[model samples]
Target: MGMHVNEVCINCDRAVADHTQKYCPNCGQPTPVHRIDWHFLGHELEHSVLHMDRGILYSLKQLMLRPGPLLRDYIEGRRGNQVKPLLLITMMSAAVVLLNRLITGGGFMDEGFSQTEAMGQALPAEALRFIAAYRSVSAWIESHFAAFTLMLLPIEALVFWLVFKRYSRLNYPEWLVVTTLLTVQTFVIWSVLVLVHRWLPQTQVLAGVLGMIYTAASLMQFFQGRPLGSTLWRTILALAIFSLASSAAVVAAVIAVMWIG
Candidate 1:
């Protein structure tokens, strides 16, 4: 018999012999020997997340090209080839936060502070003092806006779930997935607007209009089989309810902070 050859597993770093073995015994990962060179890196990239199919790029393409059909497929139990909704949203949120920081040196904090200042004038001196003292907290929230956005995912999911419960058979978690994917799309739109804001400083209004239209369209597409008028009205009501709930929560937080201080 020929001499047995042993090779180190790239992932587990354990000795893996048996040339006939296709996977590492310790980690069960594929045993592909990749050389330490640019070509190997390129090969890995082609097979990994940068692959043309079954990767983030693929998911993003599908989302843009056929979000309704893509989401419908995922919800209807055909999720083998798609990226996880939560992962996509989380990645997109991080990308948004990073892009915002790089472009604006701050992510929404300036607007937050402007709003706070406007509100401060209406509040009592004591409340204003409290707001000033908690300015750092606001900054922290702004800096970590991505996390806060994720926190709103459940509320968004609930809005859709409640509105479409009678009209669709999907449950809350499924709605959560839908909301997450839609939010990812919104983040992409927001990123584009941020890039264009330098030339068109007044794009905020346009962004708002586009966001509303996108949400309405996405909701209608999600409930595609439903009547168009019914879907439109439910989408409007859901959006109104979500906005009110969000505003109330923000006001309540501010009041609680002032009361504590």
Candidate 2:
């Protein structure tokens, strides 16, 4: 038999791969294995790698310059030199998570240790104090993830649609893509929060909600370019519905993670 690489990566990019492999360690960018000295596919594989790398860079550059434009451009004829929208977003999100762990110096799950104490449990003082503290920190992050997502996303979308209503060019789904892009941005923000934690109070909880509002406002203003829309009250109601839907999605994600993984 021969060995091969799989995605549940063992190699520490600090980010955990979602699956396991026999030959390769890091799955985010995995190396192909040649078991029987087969020389074929190298050229094709190399081209694939170069193309993907270029696309990622292009996407990143676009993301930095015009966060609102990247998704729309990708949806247009301009593809291949950019990462697939969903995959790029997900991995970037995961990378931010990985980077956050590096900055924070531990996994968010470790925060679970702290919850035990809050539950009215008593234990030897020295036995697990460190673990408890670690877990507490992680648990706090875990608990806030969905709340953070819900608090900002839909309201921002509503704001976006309203601000650009006059332009009449962008619709809700278009606005939604911009909001979706924030998922990756949300990951990016997490990494920053850790660095901010060292010097200032970390307010992932508060900042996340606020950032959602800020992001929504920025996007709406960008599209609006002239003035705000009239249906402020209606937009607010729509935002509530959208946020509720997002909450349901988050709950589903958590349950799916639990049930499947």
Candidate 3:
């Protein structure tokens, strides 16, 4: 059965070209703009949270199965079906944060750390002091994991664009979008690792290792026809650059704080 529509576009006041049209010709709003109600809210909730045909689950599956081609397609203007990259990352980060909280028994710190004290008693004097001094910042990061993770996107995108500028047609903004998608992938992987950590605490570094591999593989596949070895090396180099730059930034921040104090 066809959806009942209004005589005029409820959004744009434009005449409905056809009563059978599902959306307005002028603004693309639904022909019948239903008022907010329990049924409407319930339907919206279902679509946003549990819809599998198209949305987070679908986007995640595509990202996992063919991340390279998916990114390529999205960058090339085929994004009608996928979730917005930033929104996906935000949602994934929220999910990861929730899982981490659940696993940590509602604590801000990770598995082994005490809720009252972020650092252990056996740590060196300097290390313990540093942790104590930055306890608030650490707690903020634990709470706003998504925002904290996104703070690195600009640098990540910058490095990505610089490294692959000559090889790809994508510009800086496009690279940012690509990085956002990859970060969402990272959140998904991190969530899994959080669960795995519950079982085997020894695999602390596995998330980083797997994230790097997935990123490298995605890049290699995205830039098809490039030699895998060359692409892999370049990806590793980009990661190395990001790591060095971020480490330097942290060191500089600490030094500046110490000097100020």
Candidate 4:
């Protein structure tokens, strides 16, 4: 349906020769006057949260319930009615961090340090020193974890690309989008485990196991039409590669920090 054009195109400030024209000829922006009126505000409010086809709530529901199909659809150019992957992941990451802060009373770093200290002689002296430095800067890391996630996404996507390149049709950028969605889903699962830790003993272990399982299952589902055995084995290998890369990155960062210190 075309927008009801008024006197001028609010977006381009161009005079409309045809009042029935839905877009401005000069700039091609939609001609709807997005003014602050009760009717406009009400319409926006209603569609923002309750629209059945799109928005954050709808995205979240789709991601949680049918991630493989949602991602496949988005990757195949059916994305007009869906939330962008980056926006969805960023919002999810922020929500996870905020919820963790509330649940832990902002002492997450302290808890982390205590856990590291409990490791005792298992950690080398240099590693211990690194942990001390990390503890001091842990708050900064936690606050900027969303940015960290974004930075690491390409690496994760690289793992996927390498593992599935021979059989898959997706390019690196599409794989990156898939990785972003997967990462957000993992974080959401972790948030749930953290929220229910009191009732569920060993929730950390459970979360880790569940995360691996979900990753494998999601890979198989997303790579539909491939042989089941091929998908499963490739997913497992990709996950192992990603884990090693992540650990190596951490070790390199710590070594660099210790050297600089």
lDDT agreement with native, every candidate = 0.75, 0.53, 0.77, 0.76
Between prediction 1 and prediction 4, the one with superior lDDT is 4
148-261, model 2: which lDDT tens digit per residue?
Answer: 544555566666577557645767766666666655565555556666766644435544565455455544444445444533333444456665765565455555444443
Residue 128 shift from truth in candidate 1, angstroms:
3.3
Off by over 4 Å in 1: 1-28, 33-41, 112-127, 130-137, 202-208
How well does candidate 2 match the true structure in TM-score terms? 0.47
Clashing pairs in 4: none
Q: Cα deviation in Å at residue 49, candidate 1?
A: 3.7
Total residue pair clashes for candidate 2 = 15
Which ranking of candidates, highest lDDT first? 3, 4, 1, 2
In model 4, what lDDT does residue 52 have? 83
Q: Write the per-residue lDDT of candidate 4 for residues 1-261, one digit (tens) a residue.
A: 124446777666688777577778888976655556899888887777568888777877787788779888889888777777888788877876776667745533354357678998899987789886666456656778788778788999999899899988889998998888888778778778768756874544566578778877877788778788999898889888888887687667666766778
lDDT string, candidate 3, 43-158, tens digits? 88778656886777889999988999999999999987788888998888887778766774553343333543544676787766555545444576677777877888899899
User: Ten-residue segment with the worst summed lDDT in candidate 4?
Assistant: 104-113
The segments of candidate 2 whose C-alpha lies over 4 angstroms from its true place after superposition are 1-54, 69-81, 105-176, 229-261
Error of 4 at 170 (Å): 1.2
Q: Measured by TM-score, how close is model 1 to the native structure?
A: 0.79
lDDT for 241 (candidate 1): 86
Error (Å) of candidate 3 at residue 147 is 1.9
